[model samples]
Target: MSTEDIDVMVYDYTVAHGAIPAPLNFMGFPKSCCTSVNEEVCHGIPDKSVILKSGDIINVDVSTIYKGYYSDASRMFMIGKVDKKKQDLVAITKECLRIGIEAAKPWAFMGNIGAAIGNYAHKRGYSVVREFGGHGVGVEFHEEPFVCHVGKKNTGMLLVPGMIFTIEPMINMGKKDIYVDAANDWTALTIDGMPSAQWEHTVLITEKGAVSLTY
Candidate 1:
């Protein structure tokens, strides 16, 4: 489906549930959802100008505001007849997200989240995007305690119960450097023109372990 169609679908769904798309009006963002394909990294604008093709891997990011609360998440989708390398990138990117979440625990340092994800991605010959990691979100669209996807363990903020945030890792098959498209100034593209994949979920820190609010 076109990105515009996806945006409408999400907008309607949110309204049906007495909610709203958080990105719809925030910071002048034009779409209800973000659709990033292939080399595109994040904040891609939904437009009728672009169309999905076979073998393409697309990342659909969705965030919703409901009852003064917010939840954010994203997932990758492979079009028909994808290559093994691209397929593996998607799978590994998801695994990176899982690894980060697994490391989030009470009293643990926030840096552990990125260290776990970064180490795994590096070991697999992939680079994690350090420019944009994750952030706290709940009553607002974006908040404090920026979560980095690349850092040293036992550093940064100390994890505590009742903290809400997201762990979204953007993994690149090529170099981690990225550039924003000048035309729109929103879509971020990998500099090497190689494939990139990302996975995200909002989570809540609990006394026991991390609970995925957007799972």
Candidate 2:
């Protein structure tokens, strides 16, 4: 199916539930959601011409706004019969998100999230994309505290209770370099033409620990 199909489905679901697809028209982003395939990193505009094929991996980023609140999440999908290397990349990237979330504890520095995710991905022969990471989400689409997925622990802003943000790590199979598509000026792709994967989860830092608000 094409990325547009996913967009339409997301639009329909959001409307049916009396919620809005947060990404639609946010900062002039036209789609209801983002679908980044293979080398495409993030902010990939959903298009009818872009079709999915076997051995391809795609990231479907979905965001919702309901009752003046927001939530965001994304997951990687392998079409069929993906190569071993691509499979490993997806697995490693998912683990990056997991570790990133695991490191988000109350009173801990925001850099702890990046430190855990970056080190884990690096050790596994993967590079974390630094151009875009997670962000604060709740009362607004994109808020303060830009979450970076590469930094040292015990540094950056301290994570206090009742704070919420996203933990998305874009991992590349090749080098960490990336560039935005000039034609659309939205879709980001790997500079070396290698595959990339990403996973996102909105986290809420509670008095006990950081909990995933969008899972």
Give Cα-based local distance difference scores for all models. 0.93, 0.94
Give the per-residue lDDT digits (tens) of candidate 2, residues 1-215: 99999999999999999999999988889999999999999989999999999999999999999999999999999997999999999999999999998899998999999999999999988999999989999899889899999999999999999998999999999999999999988999999999999999999999888898877
Candidate 2: clashing pairs of residues: none
Task: Estimate, for each residue in 152-210, the C-alpha lDDT of model 1 and write its tens digit.
Answer: 99999999999999999999999999999999778999999999999999999999999
The stretch of ten residues in a row with the least summed lDDT in candidate 2 is 206-215
Return the TM-score for each candidate structure: 0.98, 0.98
Runs in model 1 with CA error above 4 Å? none
Q: Model 2: how far is 195 from its true place, Å?
A: 0.4
RMSD of each: 0.8, 0.7
